[model samples]
Target chain A: MRIGELAERAGTTTRALRYYESRGLLPARRAVNGYRTYDEDDLRLLQQIRTLRDFGFELEETRPFVDCLRAGHPAGDSCPASLDVYRRKLAELDALIGQLDAVRTQVGAQLARAELEAGAALPGGPEPRCELTHNGPTD
Target chain B: MRIGELAERAGTTTRALRYYESRGLLPARRAVNGYRTYDEDDLRLLQQIRTLRDFGFELEETRPFVDCLRAGHPAGDSCPASLDVYRRKLAELDALIGQLDAVRTQVGAQLARAELEAGAALPGGPEPRCELTHNGPTD
Candidate 1:
């Protein structure tokens, strides 16, 4: 089928298909009229790309899986390169989650501290603490 | 002090200070020569904005803290509005961490499954499993 039909069948946009073609992720066959065309195998490749994308894989990261499929593997993950991409993606996600969690903890602490200070300064609350003290012995 | 001095003290670029000014997070005074100037208080506000930004808060998100400091609060986070921003940031961080964690789990699972399949299909290993079966065995 043509680009539009393949995009429609794949639940993606023609623009995205064009971009994939530009990136050489999904190269299309040209008809005698110079129109881009795709076959069922192309649809399967597109499906694999979409699934990896939905899993938060970057467009570039999906290349290994696409190459694996084009190499005629039964599944996109059937190649060592695709498995390597999966491992790298998992590590990146883990590191990102760790950083975000640390930030969340710090933000949470700041919020709690600020709220407590605000509460203490409210009208009719306990008198604010004083830090002044005599250096020498008091009379 | 002039914009240059403020930028130097704040460890940021004049361009960033100008951007904050454009966002109205920091409004500078004009010297008699028409050059933008800032005071010690503006330095405090800028510091607050910078700290929050370093923590991944959006430029817009730093407004309440800047406003709180401008309103004569002891700290940028002293006002209720600042506390509100903190709460919102914490919630945003939590939701983001959750989503990333989910994706990480999925990617990890996919990697493990793929590796296992690759292991099972290694050359010279046990025969691949066959799904076909006869309804009855010959007596």
Candidate 2:
């Protein structure tokens, strides 16, 4: 199949396919007519790359999975290298979630403090009062 | 002080200060020597911008805080506009954290399933036992 057909069948752009080729993630063959040719295997590799990308895997991180598929594994994650990438991604996500949660807590605290201060500084806000003359109602 | 001095005191780059000026967030005054000048008030605004930025606020989001400080509020968050920005940021963070958590769960599940399949597909993986010869132990 031609590059355009492969891109259409894979639900990706020819530009993206070219970029993958540039990165050597999905190399295409040169046809006799000097056009870029791809096979169903290349489409499978592109699909794997796209799926991992949807899972937040960086383009480079998808390399191991692509390599696994190219090496004739039944699935991308069938290789130890691909499994290592998955483990690393899990760790990276955990660390990012932890950091973002901390930031959320800090921002929440700051917002609360600022709101209180703004309220207290408002015009006609609560003021300390003397109760010497109103002692009968002190209770 | 000149732009350099303000940048140094604010712990920011002159390029950043210039960019802020270009964005009209921290416009500096021109001196008789044709140099851009800033004051302590500008420094306070810059500090507010930097603090919110460290808290993951976008450069544009810091505008309200800077405006609040320029309006002579005790702090950036003393104004309704800045508080609005805070509220919006909190909501944004909440939504983002929720999405990231969902993604994390999905990636973790994928990893777990892939690992199990890979283990099962190992060359020497578990095989069905032959119990026909052990009829006496079938109970």
**Could you say which candidate leads in TM-score?**
1
lDDT of 1 by residue, A25-138 (tens): 999999999999899999989988887777777899899999998888887888999999988887888777777777777778777777777888876676443321112211
lDDT of 1 by residue, B14-123 (tens): 99999988978899889889999889999989888877877888999999988888888888888888899998888888878877777777677777777777888876
How displaced is residue A34 in candidate 1, in Å? 3.6
Model 1 scores a TM of: 0.86
Q: Which ten contiguous residues of candidate 2 chain B have the minimum total lDDT? A: B130-139
TM-score of chain A of each: 0.85, 0.84
Candidate 1 chain A worst ten-residue window by lDDT: A130-139
Cα error, candidate 2, residue B130 (Å): 26
Q: Report how large a share of the reference interface contacts model 2 reproduces.
A: 0.52
Which regions of candidate 1 fall more than 4 Å away from where they truly are? A123-139, B123-139
Error of 1 at A114 (Å): 1.3
DockQ of each: 0.33, 0.27
